[model samples]
Target: MTRVAVIARILPVLAILVWSLQGVSRAENALTLDLSDYELTFEEDFDRLDVSAWGPGTRWIAHTPWNGDFGDAAFADPRPGFPFTVKDGVLAIEARKDEGGKWASGLLASVDGAGRGFSQRYGYFEMRAKFPKGEGTWPAFWLIGLDRLTHTSEVDVVEHYGHFPGRYTASVHVWDRKTASKSSSVHHRVLVAPGSLYDDYNTFGAKIDADWIIFYFNRQEVWRQSTPEHHKQPMYLLVDLGVGAGWPTENTPDPSVMLVDYVKVWARED
Candidate 1:
């Protein structure tokens, strides 16, 4: 996810909490909603890359619903094997440079501009992925509010930059379209051992409810903040292999690939 305005000294750093996962246990590989007091609502194991369907009633679109393509790469549409590929139940979102020196990448949204697809008002959303390592590689999993007429609410589950080896950010933003300003915003950084994220797959998740929005790394709580008022409505999902987040992409890995094992969401069973 990209920030709309330049975060100068004006935007206060709400929290800077760090949890080192040095010796964390990696038990319980299987994901289940029963123990969490929730029910499975949506899941995408990437059995296949369905590019033919890219609109309302479909599973995904190639770009953001608002057509905002951020970072150093253009979110390219699905092609033969350029930006997207599926093999053995894994989805690889690739970023590469073309002969013309233009960078193109892949992004997938759960809904289209017409506000049709899978979305939930509040739930626990998770993505298990292995991030690409190299300067200028930006991978993110985020959510945006469905109601885009007036204001917009955003929840960034995980935004990892390649330069920062074992650090990622999660944030919440409430932007008012009429005033073009963020009414509420908060940013937090989570840290672990350097280069640990690039070695293997890890899970990043967020739990959103009426009172708070909590972030989790490997299913462990890391940070939390009050849920914005505008975010109470249903929101859709987006995962992308971006290029640069206010950094240089000249030395970026030509074919940086982000492998996603799965994306799943569970709604409270109440």
Candidate 2:
């Protein structure tokens, strides 16, 4: 077992009181999540980047298991404080231009090439983070369903593009292998005042159940959708500071840093 798995097994479970929503309207009535009914399944506090190119014991891999690296900046391999670094219990995924002027950044996935690592079928996943601001910075925390042999299912917990400082996006997608098309997809925009996200840390979360996929920002419901059929399989985690999600990178800060305080997951009790 990986060190993270061992740590989770030994840690004590704690109760957390999150939001409670009564209806579809977030403002109508507030509700609370009785976290006592759940068990902590995964936790990464970024004491250090416990990552590798491909791993047998590490908690993260430097690239996607399928090698599908997106965005304008390349997801470079883990090195000494270039694309990724840890200090004061926080992880900084950096997007920067090298001496040669080529853009490179960092991405970390919970699974490796062989599909070996952490994954869950249904759970609550969350990340506390502060994003970098500029014209081309693209920071995101997302999940990919593991049944890659047939089709692809994705849930974008939060995708923040720096050009649009006033809002961010979330999406759920299902792609068909046979038709080579996205058979189902939906997107939502969560609005905030400009420069707010870059100024402080905020929590992004998703609750995945058999029937629904609910999104939360700072512990409050922001958006939700019916669980896609393709998303019934297990899903894994990924976080990255990418440059240019179809946006211009010329004005992107020379060294943009996305700080993550923690990434965690909790499985429901039966």
Q: List the residue pairs that clash in candidate 2.
A: 19-31, 20-30, 20-31, 20-32, 21-31
Model 1 alpha-carbon miss at residue 259, Å: 0.3
Off by over 4 Å in 1: 4-35
Tens-place lDDT per residue, model 1, 20-111, is 23323232343333236889999899999765335755688888888777777999878898688999999999999888998999999998
Q: After the best TM-score superposition of candidate 1, give how far the Cα of residue 86 lies from its true spot, in angstroms.
A: 0.4
Quote model 2's TM-score: 0.87
* Alpha-carbon local distance difference test for all models: 0.81, 0.80
Q: Model 2 over residues 91-133: C-alpha lDDT tens digits?
A: 9999888889989999999999888999999899999999998
